[model samples]
Target: MKLKQLSVALFTAATLTAGSNSKADTITTPEVITKTTSAFFNCADYEVVGVCFWLYCTITGCTVKTSAKVAHYNPEITTQTYRNAEKPPWVETRVMLDAMQAGHDGSLIGIILETMGSGLDELGGGAGSENKAASHSNMTFTLTDSFGNPVLLASKVIGSSGYVCDPQLTPMYPYYVSNLDTVAWRFSIPEMFYPQSLNPFGSLLGSNSYNWGGYYPRIGHVTNHDLVKESGLIAFRSAHFLSRRGESHVYTTIAQNSREGFWPPGPLTEHSGKWQQLAPKGETSCKTFPLSAGTGPSDGLSGYRSDDGAHVWNLWRRYKCCKDRGDFLYDIEW
Candidate 1:
């Protein structure tokens, strides 16, 4: 049983009873962080699969299919910094929508977008050039009702300032996003196991190189080539591991260009040494460094050394860098 199939089955059983309010209208579980769990399913078990708003929903009997958009945030930088000092020069926000399915069992859909409004004014000065509007990212979950109408399940707001490290400005103390709120309703699915299933409702897909917090040197590298050039070295890989516990982390490798071939491979050359270092070889911990325009001290090294001199490597947790024109590699191990 794949996650999508299980979700559809649960949805069908829950809604089978006729009533003025659909079973989905009410959440039986309390809204607590611990209550959220990853649901699994097998696509081979279902005849049809659908996704919406990054939520995977599958139907065994119905043919209705829907698409969804997974929103993303675009941050504008006025200036760039490699350290925790300078303030970011300019800031802007953009949104992206991706396709999703609604049938995945125990699957959840959410959106992330950077927004500007009164929320910025509350930070300090009124909306002015000097006091640019504070940017926000909103993650929303969506689902379909008994009638198959697309509906929003839940939403949460996150601030941009806290996540990025600036070189100049004093670090904002206790960085926090002020209007923190959660949607009253959330989608629910059945419990099942599914593998190699297409989760249209979730933003991260096998085709995408970057995971939740893992960074990619460029965007197009994972989704398309054109966008690759526009992507900056991963400032940081988002903490996807924590968000989706129990779910196996997937890593994809890119072929090394001629320039990359010249560099000495790291200890984990078998698995793209650089990626192993960033993601690590085990389930305990995974971390990657911030990427800069030029190579740093750790440039070109095939493996990463822990503080104790332990060399741990894996392709899934590696990162690559470039010098004048050659290739450099870095690994993340714990």
Candidate 2:
């Protein structure tokens, strides 16, 4: 029989076994059954067959082995966090973005989900090992409608964070790099229309230190130096992606600070070491304008610009307290 037909038949047989239990009254041995019909019999079904046979011998009822091997099945459903394998509810993504835009001030939502795999080099020694080490997790953002639905964002790959020798940098610098120019991969989502405004700089604006009394220092402060200036948009790098695939592919990072923003620079900044404004007053729209004659190469990051020449970052920052409270920043659907 065809594979599809076989699958259906196996499922039907299993269902029949469950229903047949009420019809049998007594139990019997397997030896009394001499007629072999199907070649599917196995030792595992001895107990089930014995039960049915005994019932037949004692009550003159039918004796047929109904157990069948069937394929295992699982359905995608939404869970509380992206870390969970199950798909989140359809509305979860939208609710998350709304909460973030309204409460977080436009900060990009950083998610550190499961890793793709381990990267332990068997041939590399001390220096080579350090140069080839992996990161800890991968990351993705949620674009929802107030209810969760997977929405795609425009992004590009960038270099990894440069190497540092300080012990304080170990936690954030989970991966090794041979050079400084290797673009650390991150997703750059430009400013899109949201009903509420997000607080992109709240984390840096509110905190005095990187650590909020935890075993590890806050990752946001460790990864980006611009946070101190509080002048640029935020962008997150996923530890999960770095750890699993290195910095060659597209992925995101999670930021530990809850008050930072992750968007790109505005028009007032210097394109070539001189300040220039690109928008009019009270305008908050992102337009596809051509680069100026002397403008430097585009950095391939995403953000928003205001008419007054102010730019914001779009990196996702996480609060330790918010995680324990079941208030996730974003969710994903299959």
Model 1 C-alpha lDDT per residue in residues 220-313, reported as the tens digit of each score: 1122111111111211111221112232222111122233212212222112212212111122222222212223344433222122111111
The parts of candidate 2 lying over 4 Å away from their true place are 1-218, 222-233, 236-245, 248-334
Residue runs of model 1 more than 4 Å from their true location after superposition: 1-237, 240-288, 292-315, 318-334
How many clashes in each candidate? Answer: 77, 61
lDDT of each: 0.18, 0.18
lDDT comparing candidate 2 with the true structure: 0.18
Instruction: Give the per-residue lDDT of model 2 (tens digit) for 133-160.
Output: 5743222211111100010000111101
Q: Give the TM-score of candidate 2.
A: 0.15
Q: How well does model 1 score by local distance difference test?
A: 0.18
Reference-based lDDT, residue 54, model 2 = 15
